[model samples]
Target: MLNGKVVAITGGFGQLGVAVVQGALAAGAKVAALDRAPAPAAASNLGDALALGGLDLAEPDVAARALDEVARKFGGLDALVNIAGTFRWEELEQGSVDTWDLLYRVNLRSAVSTSRAALPHLTRRGGGSIVNIGAGAAAARAAAGMGAYTASKAGVAKLTEALAAEVKDRGITVNAILPSTIDTPANRADMPKADFSRWVAPKSIADTILFLLSDSARDITGALIPVSGRV
Candidate 1:
């Protein structure tokens, strides 16, 4: 569905990020996988997708340089998936104020920086899509100990709407996927007793993101689609 299009994914070394990269490549897109972690040897499994590691996407200059590199390498950029976010479960009273700051930078600011950097390239190509990974819990309601995380993700949801409206006239569409309890290794390790089957799979979310990037979803913008699986 993404034939010959260039797609860049942030947090590309993580489980979910890898799934998105593989899906996009399978759909005939050239992908640039950017992550804060060093490129793992297993990155070879991504076929020919470009792997750019050790990136601090929250920094505007860093994001700009990384995205500019992707555009230069791929001739231009068509879509971007902002999946570089961190989560922390902490009640406001028990958690340090630093936790809130950290989550805000990692979860919300990174998307803002990266999307801003990708705008020129996408506009130059006449149109593009941006898919942000938001938390379903955040969008619906925040539970106890989820203040910082939910607040950060809520910022992402708002960013999706504001950016979508800002770029609508430029043929750019921005949307977000709100997933509940993604079935990742980290989540499984963190909640061993939880019902894993109820959680959404990384591949499932990746497929949804690809659909948003495809022409089929060209008219869909500022949408916060919920992908909660059985959860």
Candidate 2:
């Protein structure tokens, strides 16, 4: 369904990002993987995917540069998936200003910067899609020490809604996906005793992202879809 399209994914080297990059490529879309980390050892599995170094999302200029580079390399840009983010598990008392700033920079500011940078590209293409990854914890009350993380995600959700309204008439769609607890390798290693089966899989999330980026989702905008696997 994504044939001939070019998709840009931030944090494209991480677990979920890997799934998205591979998935997009398999679906016949030109994939641009953007991440602060370098590309992993190339495997025969990735066909024609391209990896690009991305800057800290909080840096406005970096966002613009990344988008420009994508447009130049791919001839045009079709979709942007803001999968870059930071997570911290700290109590309210233990949370320092630096921690709050760092998380906000990665989780919230990155999406804002990326969306703004990709807007003109999407407009020029006549229409496109932006998918922001969010956390479900933002919908519930604080969990004693997740105040800052929760607040950052709340900002993401609100930003998605506001941006959707701003770009709806321009043929662009903005939406956020709230996943409860993703079953990533890091999460599995961190919580060995947890039920891995209950956690949402990275490929599953990527599937949803692919759907939203496809032409079939042209009418779906401003929606905060939940990808929590029965949690």
Candidate 3:
């Protein structure tokens, strides 16, 4: 579906990120997987996808450099997937303000900085798609311990809307996928007794993201689509 497309995905070393990278590659796109974590030791599964690690995407200079490298390697950029984020369960009363700051930096700021960096390249391609990973919790009311995480994710949702409008005339589209508790290994271990069947799968989210990036959804932008799997 993405043949000849050059796509870059942030947080590409994690479970969901890995799924998206593989899916994009299968769709015949030149993929670049950027992450703050170290590159995986056995990345043969990533095929010819470029794996760039130790990037702090919240920093504008860092994000710009990373994306510049991707554009240099791929010849151009056509899509971006912002999946770098973190979650913390803590009540405001018990949590340090630092938690909120950390979430903001990692979740919202990272997306903003990376998207800003990618704009020139995407514009040079005449158009491109940007997909962000938001949270279903943020779309709805926050639970007792979800204030910080939800707040950060809500910022991401708002960024999608605002940036989409700002770049629509430039032929760039921006959207976000709001997912419920994803059924990853870490989530399973955290909620061992929970019904794993109800949680969304990483591949499910990846498929939705791929659709958003393709020409099939070229007219869709600024949409905060919910991809909750019965959650």
* Highest-TM-score candidate: 3
CA lDDT of each prediction against the hidden true structure:
0.94, 0.89, 0.95
In candidate 2, position 46 carries an lDDT of 45
Point out the higher-scoring one by TM-score: 2 or 3: 3
Candidate 2: stretches off by over 4 Å: 44-46
lDDT for each residue of candidate 3 in 56-119, tens digit (9 for 90 to 100) = 9999999999999999998999999999999999998778999999999999999999999999
Candidate 2 lDDT score at position 52 = 72
Each model's TM-score, in the order given? 0.98, 0.96, 0.98
In candidate 3, how many Å is residue 161 off?
0.1
Alpha-carbon RMSD to native, per candidate:
0.9, 1.3, 0.8
Worst 10 residues of 1 by lDDT: 39-48
Give the clashing residue pairs of candidate 3, or none: none
Query: How much does candidate 3 score in TM-score?
Result: 0.98
- lDDT score, candidate 3, position 14: 87
lDDT tens readout by residue for model 1, 139-171: 766789998999999999999999999999999
Clashes of each: 0, 0, 0
| Model 2 lowest lDDT segment of ten | 38-47
> lDDT value for candidate 1?
0.94
